[model samples]
Target: MQRNAFMLLMDEPRSTLDPIATAQVDELIDELRQNYLVAVVTHAMHQAARVSQKTAFLHLGNLVEYGETGTVFANPTDPRTESYITGRIG
Candidate 1:
């Protein structure tokens, strides 16, 4: 069957996969982004950097920052965001 989707919410879709499988899933998510708004919640910062066009960084149930993925990861405006992305915090 076929269906129409406006947005896709994926929470660690690659969690249990090995490197090869994770790469495959990342590729598929990238492809799917062409047609759907894909929101991924992942702890893997590298994976987030790869597949997301926009990113939202959260800490302790609070939103620290939200913006273009590159900007948030490369030059975050908030110290909390920076700390988390830089491995200062888990």
Candidate 2:
């Protein structure tokens, strides 16, 4: 049988995987992006920066920022987003 999926939602997809396995999953996510919208929820900032084209920052159950990954990482507008990314807060 053939199946079709529109979007993929993942929560901490690599939280338990070893380095090699994590790389493999990252690659898979890259490939899947060609055909599906992928949303990943993770606490690993580096992974999020590496794998996401767009990023969102949430704090205390509120949305703080959302934008292109590079901008979000390099020039976040919110102080809380900057703090979390810079390891000052979480």
Candidate 3:
């Protein structure tokens, strides 16, 4: 069988995955990003930290911050970003 959705922008496909399998898909997305452009919508900050070299913070449909992952995580220019990273606020 094929590995994953390289570009799932068209056609209806059944999501026949259990919780464990779904998690695997997330991991695969992170790995596939090394060779392809991947856009992942996730709420887990740590997950973004693991998969992305760049992190973008979106609050209320507005782009609040965008930059290097390490720089943003370690020192965010936006107060919201800082709070999100430090687990103080989100």
> What CA root-mean-square deviation does each model show from the true structure?
1.6, 1.9, 5.8
lDDT digits (tens) for residues 8-67 of candidate 3: 221111155565765676677666767666665666666667666877888889999999
Error of 2 at 27 (Å): 0.3
For residues 1-90, write the lDDT of model 1, one tens digit per residue.
Answer: 137878888999889899999999999998988988889999999999999989999888888899999999999999989989999988
- Model 2 has an lDDT value of 0.92
Q: Which stretches of candidate 2 lie over 4 Å from their true place?
A: none
Off by over 4 Å in 1: none
Residue 82, candidate 1: C-alpha displacement in angstroms? 0.9
* Candidate 3 accuracy as TM-score: 0.66
Whole-model lDDT, model 3: 0.69
Ten-residue stretch with the least lDDT total in model 3: 7-16
User: Model 3, 89: alpha-carbon shift in Å?
Assistant: 2.9
Tens digits of per-residue lDDT for model 2, 1-90: 127878999899899889999999899899989998999999989889999999999888999999999999999999999999999986
